[model samples]
Target: MSIHHRIATAAAAAVAAVALVLVGAGPAVAGSPHFIKNATTASLDGTSLVVDFKEAGLESGSVETITVTAHLDATFSCVNGGNNVPSDPKKTTISDEFSNSDDFTAGKNGNVVGSLPLSPPAAASVLDCPKGQKATLISGTWSDISIEDETSGAFLAIPGSFSF
Candidate 1:
């Protein structure tokens, strides 16, 4: 071929190669989730606590496992006083740890919904309110939350909290 024709052909080939690479990389990039969004506590009962969260930015299957440590506040305590007495506001603090990976399927905006069961002592601390008073979960601190990513093989730390 002529010199100009050869140069034009080379340039076109390079462009086409780059396009192919980008197209091939789309799936891998789309499968990785970078952050967790809409993470909220669905319910906090004496038995178990459930949290619902969705993956954001990228697609699902990036996070293989999510480990969470939660700090819970017990708002009321039953004092050893007589009947019809007001319950003391003596707050008790408790903690629990759990993990979930069910909702992390191969899709975008994946929802990871799961629960952690409380031990008997832990449940009693939360449910031991006196009569005429309701046992309450005042606040929850979700700390030391880590996610293991399938693509990167890295553990990412995420911290969050909520109040009732």
Candidate 2:
């Protein structure tokens, strides 16, 4: 073949090879369906329960809304004259469910790290205590903590319950 013709043929072959490689790698590069990675954690930041998680296989720069849900079991003690009120039920247990949602943007690597905060119920009220007593929060536990992809309505795995 002539010099120019040989060069043109070589360039076309290179282009075709590159195209085939890209086509073969397309699905892998796109990655699997988005999912919440393991090792997700829940902890307390002051009175608010914070859930931290990492979502993998997301589309880069895409936005996702995630919701964190947990059931809170809190204990409060009724006090009168700076001491526990023995006559009244000294301890009261409160159980409730709470959830919070936040938006997270995937990074260039198609992964997102985000945190959502859920506020615990307020301290017990006077109605929870004897007439002359005040209520004080003693301790709290968050159980069945779960993370969900609100956009897809899929629940993700979490470590376990936490205490505060």
Candidate 3:
């Protein structure tokens, strides 16, 4: 074979080898699990706190469960005598965790999306007020919000907290 032909053949083989290596590595990299940027979000919907999150690079067709958790800080006011009487406002800090879960199947792109709706404890239920006094929620905050993958026991996202 001519020298020029031999050199051309060697260059083609090298390029093909590199291309094969990259092709083989693609799936391994794509199959790794990760959280999509800005895809996880939290907001207050009426009396419920809604959390939405997206995870990618999961096993396709696999069943996955995500759990959302947060700590609630609530403030309440108790009034009597139809606002004719004034008293100190009561504040309650609920350190206990409130959580919700959702189940989803990973799509063909190895992505899963889910939402969790968390409801805060009622002010009347958690507060003590004298007879004829009404308990009202003044304000509340859901802090330390986080989303976890229940199937893998890994944290997918932590979008912080929201207030209402």
Candidate 4:
């Protein structure tokens, strides 16, 4: 091959290698959910209503399902419990406090798919939430929730939900 042809071939090969590296290092695909967030907020009014939450996010086609698990977290009480969040509300009795795990499936493009309810739980807590004078993500061991997406085979956990 001529010297010019040899130089052209070498340049093409270098470009191809650089392109491969760049693509490999780039961020995940557009459909890949950067994070799975459960914006749903749960609350209670003296054991009248049991709240629940479901993680929300854009899914990476890889994530077909996600598991929602609870954590051991807490909310602080206030001297003037008025306007207090469920963590430490003043007048009402907070009955159900549970710490358990649940699962959900991913929607199209990482959308939120399911909700894990607080009142009717898969597992019941031994302790009565309203009886206690504190905050602990309902009446259970899981103060926070965990979400494991099957697509990426990863876990994302959160405690609080959007009050919606």
C-alpha positional error of residue 72 in candidate 3 after TM-score superposition, expressed in Å:
1.6
For candidate 3, lDDT tens digit of each residue in 1-164? 99999999999999999999988875433365766658988889975788888888787788888888888887777777676334565545565689988788988778898778999878788778778887777678888888888785657556566777
Q: What lDDT tens digits, residue by residue, belong to model 2 across residues 1-164?
A: 89999999999999999999988875334355345555467788876788888877777777888898889888887778666656646687879888998888878887778888887766665237667777777778888888887764556756677787
Backbone atom clashes (below 3 Å) for every candidate: 0, 0, 0, 25
The predicted structure with the larger lDDT, 1 or 2, is 2
List per-candidate RMSD values in Å. Answer: 7.4, 3.7, 5.6, 11.3
Whose lDDT is greatest here? Answer: 3
Estimate the TM-score for candidate 4.
0.33
Query: Arrange candidates by TM-score, highest first: which order?
Result: 2, 3, 1, 4
The residue ranges of model 3 lying beyond 4 angstroms of the native Cα positions read: 1-30, 80-85, 88-91, 157-160
Choose the strongest candidate by TM-score.
Answer: 2
TM-score of each: 0.38, 0.71, 0.69, 0.33
Cα lDDT of model 1 by residue, 1-164, tens digit = 89999999999999999999998876544444444544533444533444444444444554445443444433434443443324346456666565544324445544333433322234345667655554444445444445544443434454554344
Name the TM-score of candidate 2: 0.71
Question: What C-alpha lDDT values do all the predictions have?
Answer: 0.48, 0.76, 0.77, 0.44
Evaluated at residue 94, the lDDT of candidate 3 is 62
Q: Give the lowest summed-lDDT range of ten residues in model 4.
A: 120-129
